[model samples]
Target chain A: MPRTRPNLLERQRRRLVVPFLLPALLLYALFMLYPAFTTFYVALTEWNGVSAPEWVGVDNFTRLTDDSLFSSTITNTIVFTVLGALVLFPGAMFFGYVTQRLPLGRLYRFLILAPVALSVTTAALLWKFLADPNFGAVQKVLRAVGLDSLASVELLGRPNTAMLMVVLATVWHGIGLWMMFFAAAAERVPAELKEAATLDGASSFQVFRHVVWPLMWEVTRTLLILWMIQGLQTFAFIIAMTNGGPLRATEVIGTYLYKVAFASSEFGYAAAIAVVLFAAILVLTLLSQRLTRRESEQY
Target chain B: MNRRSLLRATAVATAVMLSLTACITSSDDGDEPETESSGGGDASGAPAEITGDLEVVSFYPEGSPDFERLSGLAEAFEAQHDGVDVTLTFGGGQDVPQIEARWRADDPPDVNYGFLDVTLPDGGPWVAAGDTMNLQPAMEQPLEGYDGTWEEAILPGVRPLISVGDDIYGAPESVTTLQFFYNEAIFDELGIEVPETFDDLIAAADTIKAAGIAPFTVTGTFLPYMQVYWDYLALRHFGLDGLQQAIAGEAELASLPGAQEAAADLEALVADGNFLDGFRGVDFTSAQMSFFQGDAAMILMGSWLIGEMAAAIPADFQTGTFAFPTVDGGSGDQDGLFGGTNAQVVAAKGQNPDAAEAWLQFIADPANQTAYVESTGGISAYTGIPAPEGFEDVTAMLEEGAAFAPSYMGVLALSQEVQTAYQQPIAQLFFGEIDGATMLTQMSEGLQAAAG
Candidate 1:
């Protein structure tokens, strides 16, 4: 059969689409796409922000192999992401489950989410004060309990404990958001299905394992990816608390990029680091989505 | 739906377009009125009679004492110059990053209050590209009231602080001398004398430590404050020139016997627990508070410390300062001091270069310099200006031929990359995670990598 021409309304709608989409498309290209392409170009040069940019194709990428600081930054980012996911995923889910069953569930949720309201900088500063070796409340309590040795340890100073402190601070501030996500997912589960599981003599854990867990896989996968991206981009708290010290122990790729660009005036090298970070996040996100994807199921 | 409605719509659209065009053209014209002359200043070596905005950006935040003094200086300049409006912008101690962003945007301020040091990559790029105006010719001219030239009015050692080779890039405004400030009561109570040699300093520190007080306290988190120890040690070990040469990568820092020994000495201090507990985690304010609270017996700080900690300092607490002790078996000048100068530079690409230069000269004049010193408790960078009443002792110390040696990180004689690479390793060395030899190796490798 011969192809039919579009109706009058369809033609008008098609013509109208350009006028409506033009502004958004132009904005995206100017702000996002333009900078991204410029970053790729900048990654291949030795521009110091002020002087003329000198082209050095692939030199920055090659230098990464010999750049111990960059390597350490990558290692730090990976460790943070993996450890953060391991802690936050189970912790948020468990808290969400327990709080949902409590008599004062709303109060519990409110209490848990209070920290999320505080800005990241404020939370980091509060934690820094609390971890102070000399006059912190934590140290005072530890000393009172006769754990003088533990009290004497400087959590934010030593390389061994600095990253751990930063991780703890990050989790404390972030756990609430993930918990709220899981709680919302739990609220959406069918009560009848839960009752049926209960009637089948399933314990709370077993019901969650068999029914709720399967249903919430989508939310859990999204949370995991979000946490991974955030962990990779962690910088503000580390900067406020440790400043990538003592001895670059907490130096993630984000902080390292900042140092390279602003502190060292190596804009090209910094752009290369940014590109690598973006690539890693993209690959990891794709892999995660592929792995977590499931066939549609009836509940 | 007749032709009349369509005609009305077109008339409204046309009216809007015409009004918008009128607004744009009027605003543009209002912003830049035609000038009678394009020259920067008139005759008699004064800033030209120009009517325009002169914007100044500074690191001194509004609440700071320096901020008020700077504002007053700008006001005085505005008062003297007719038809010139001056606006001051404060960066709250983040001037480097703020200035960097503005400079990259190609819209830097008319006058920038900053250090001219090239070691840490703060303003070095602009200086190297000649983005800042050369002030040599301006300096040769005499101030309004001062009979002598601006160059002659500046203190002997201050001009070099803001100069790269023979070209002066900025006018030196204030000076700060780093010294070992001690609680006089603690020294008197412990029956300890002011140390004059490295050995004597160590003995004094030991006595303080034995008394269950920290010998010295420093803000290790900031890193630069802790670098003072390394700077003094290097200076006392190898002379000033030798240290500069090492920083410039002309010589290996580790190869210098003095450098090696200095590293070892610093490590020894760490091993002996001479610093406050958890000093590495403390910031500058807290470290100063620890000193003021008498938790530490001594603190190595700049002259600005007296003013910064004025409120916290006890009324009965007497503070005494001494030059960094000379190292035994060292070839450096015993009286050399580590410190920095506060200078102001004019943006070459700014609209009012002559107004900026005049403002600098106004600030550098003997009368304004004295007022600034009095207000901020900072040492003046001008000669023949009597020291502020509270800082007479420091003035005397400076007068005793205590040569000025800029901090290694201050003038950025070394690239920022090299400095950053050394920062973590140096902290590790301080924490005993790495030995002196490891630190030296790391420094050498980092410098080599930067060079490559």
Candidate 2:
């Protein structure tokens, strides 16, 4: 086909597209693409943020293979994702389903999401104090229930429980958003299908398991992938609460990288860790997308 | 609730909290001494050339007394030179990261805070990296308060920390040491004498424990404090040379002759269960709270603890400071103190070298350094200053001929990666997950890899 000049309207729209999209593209390129590519180059060198970078090829990545700290962070990150998914998805779905149909649903939703209003540090501190062994609410409650010995068991002090405490705080801070996500998806479900199932003598659990659950499945899968990403990149709670301590039992990729870069000043090494993390997240997310892909059900 | 009742309840709650807080925090005798109206007064001796915009950064957060003290110094420097505008930036725990960012951009800050210790493998990080200027000249230069040079004015033990051979890279502001801060009332109540030896200390700890009080409070969360038990043990057992042998990769700490005994001593310390419950996860701040709140009878803390926790100390709480007791059969200098110096390091490639150097020299003046000690509650690096208020005993202790070794735990001069990797196994050792020998082996192996 011979090229032809665009009509006036088309020409005007094409001119508008550049004006509209150029700023966004420029910003994304500057803040994201530039740094991303720079980080790749940095990962190949031994740079201490301040000094000129010395090229070290694949040494950093090679070192990571046997690095105990790197392996622990990777393990902990995976644990965070798996444990978080186990607690978050089911709990979110259950509450989201119940809240949508329950009386005073808005109030329930508001109460459930109240923690979201608190900053991560505030929420972490709140949870930390609440679990204090001596004067915390957990101790008071445990003592009230005659679990006196257990009351003094420091939840955040021990290695296993410290990590668990961080995870719990993260979940408390985040569960609300995921719950609201499921709630919105449930709201979109056709009322007729639920009514039909109830009339067909389906118990509430049965109705949920067969009807509502299947309806929310698409949202569930999408949110699961989202939660996994959040879990992988978790940082603030660990820093504010445990600081990757109690024998570094709570360390994850994000916190480790931050320490490596900022504390140790090994920006090059940290960049290597970051590049690997980015690659892993991208590959996993794509794989998740493929694995979760399904034909949409026509109503 | 009714509005009237709500208001009444709020007032009552606030009053209760106020009283409770007062009963908990030690009396802050006074706010910081007023800055001289004469704009830093007459500089004891103004440097010949100090006219420029001097940019200084500190880890002390703004509004903190330490930050205010430093700000006062900068203002003083500015006053000395009409043309100089001293701008001080505070980052609390982030000064280094910020400095590095500025350095990467090729516009480094003129002066910033840092740790300067000879114990660092190559005279600390910036000096090792050659990013800091040699501060020996600033130290050797005459200042108003001293009969001789500023170098002679500094504590003999601390003078070596900033030097790598002939070069000095840090202008130190304070001497830091770890000591036991105990509740005086508890010690008196038990008729327990202040322990001068490790055995006596252990006995006192037992007595305190028998009274159902936590004998000590130390946080496992702060990796530095977590290493203290091992640090003192290693020093006492192996002496400075033997301890340095491990740090320098010449030997494993566990392989030393005194290693077994020191391990036993640590095992005893750990086995005693003298520390407050849940100490592992709680940070240094909480550990301090546990002590000042009277939950723990004693706490081994750095010199900054008093100032850091001044507000939390109750007026009635008699905070007693004592040096770490001497170890029996110890080869290390019994009177030796383990600490580091906080310095204001000028960048080698900074824009205003003269201003920064002069600012540092101004800081080194005896009167100025004395002001720092008097204003901020810490051990001053410069000599001839009275101890900080409430730290008189500590000052007297240092005056009695003690050696000072910069803390060697996290300041290993190794990469943070290696230090963190090394610390994990040590933490595991202290947690009873690994034996002392295993810890030494792991640490040695970890450092050996980095060394390679």
Candidate 3:
């Protein structure tokens, strides 16, 4: 049989499809694609965003090696990202499990979700009041008990302590969102599967491990990728709390990028850093997807 | 083609094109008209009646005292000149981020306030590009009751910063200077006199530390405490010209004896644990609270601290400013308190140049200067303007063989990048990890890179 091709009417209909799609495609191209392309292009030019750009080729990227704050920012970002993953992932899973088991699940959900509703800036400011070294409630209670010697300690001044404080703030602020995601995932686990685990006389922990955890791996992995991306972009809290100071101890790559771009007016250098960061994010996401696919295939 | 279908198609196409044209034309209207008026007096030099829209942009936001004063001035100018309308836009913080954004926008503010730097790192030299307007012609002519020449009016040493090669780039409005604000209760309890020399300062620190009180509370987080070290050292070792030369890439940081000595002294201070524990972790508000609560004996900060202290501390707590103590055998002059009067300048492209000039003249007047000083407890920069009554004695003391020295003024004459670069290494020196020699070498390299 000869292959039958589309007749005139069908071919004309196919042509009409492009016109219908053109407006949306044009918008996406203008807003999203253009900026992405321009960011990479600008990365190669020494433009302060003030005057005409001077083409500097790879100078911006080369300068990153010599940049004093580059290593520090990368280290800060990695530390914060790892800590965010470690603390939030396990804690969220546990909270989701507990909330599902609790008698008043609604109350538990509300309590857990309350912090997520607060803005990062507002939360940091509130924490500043709580952690304030001198006049804070914690210090007041300490001083009242003849613990006046501790009154002089600058909790926010010590680099490690400050980093810890930021981690704590971030984890607390982030817990609810991840918990909700995990809780929904765990809730969707088939009732028959859980019943079978129980019928086998599996312990409570055993059921969670064998029945619930396996079912929720996909959701957990998805949340982890999302959190990792967010963690890499973490900046507002540091800016509001520290502005990457105390000797640039809190200067993560995001804040450093902002500084290089806006503060120093080194748009080309900033663009290079931004592109590198974007590429890093893309690679991590793809790796995450690949892992999930492999795990699902095994099942 | 059917006649009716062709007509419908043409109508639809026309409608689409019309909508597109409407969108494009509307955006064109959004382009703010650029105004470039070099305001001048009438032939007789009498005040000219201004009659146009005056556009002003400030880095300071609404409700800040500086913003309030500026806006109030704008309103008053608008009312006085019926034909002039003043439009205001608020922008960036006292940081580089805001300036870059404003500079990049197609419609730059006619009256824009910027840091006293000549150029940004990526932006070519401001003077070379003529990006910034020269204020020399306007600044040269003085208004009535201004009394003194521009040089006579401003603190003598500060002229170098505002004047680039031959032009005045920025008119200083508010000068932020670092001063030692000691807790009176802590000092009194420790039985330590206010320190007059480096030895005295060390001895006082020891006494406070022995008493179990932190000797000093500082926000080293982001080099908050570094300013004191730099300003104090500059006062002792570099002198204004030497500091200026180092900042300009004309002199190497290593060549300056004061830089090494200051760096060494900072290292010593850190090693002795003279600062608040975890000082590097501390932010400004926390460190300030420590000082207010008498947990520390002293804090080094700016004149604006008075406003903060007034809000934070109890009514009865005593707070004051004093000279940074001199180093033993150091060349620093103790009397030179580091700060100067900042002047306000009208941007050349300002729409309401006449109205802007009126506000500038009003603020620069001696009477208004006194009012501004008294209201804010700031020093008067205008010649013949009396210092706020109680502050006169202290002002005279700071003025005695003392010059106004802004911490970053020298670095400012170069570019903002060099200025920000020096802050961190100096901060590292405070951390005691890096020595002064390394810092100086880094500073020279950083400055040279910025120049290139």
The regions of model 1 sitting more than 4 angstroms off are A1-8, B1-44, B50-52, B68-86, B92-95, B114-123, B388-403, B409-417, B445-450
Per-model lDDT: 0.77, 0.75, 0.68
Per-candidate DockQ vs. reference: 0.27, 0.20, 0.37
Question: Please, what is the TM-score per model?
Answer: 0.88, 0.86, 0.83
Worst 10 residues of 2 chain B by lDDT: B28-37
Rank by TM-score, descending?
1, 2, 3
Better of 2 and 3 by DockQ: 3
lDDT tens digits by residue: candidate 3, A125-211: 776666666556756777789887776555566566666677778888878878889899889888788889899999989999988
The CAPRI-style docking tier of model 1 reads acceptable
CAPRI verdict (incorrect, acceptable, medium, high) for model 3: acceptable
Question: Model 1, range B273-366, lDDT digits (tens) per residue?
Answer: 8999978777787788889889999999988887777767888888888878988888776767777677888877676777777778777777
Displacement of residue B111 (Cα, Å) in model 1 is 2.0
DockQ winner among the candidates? 3
What is candidate 3's CA lDDT for residue B313? 79
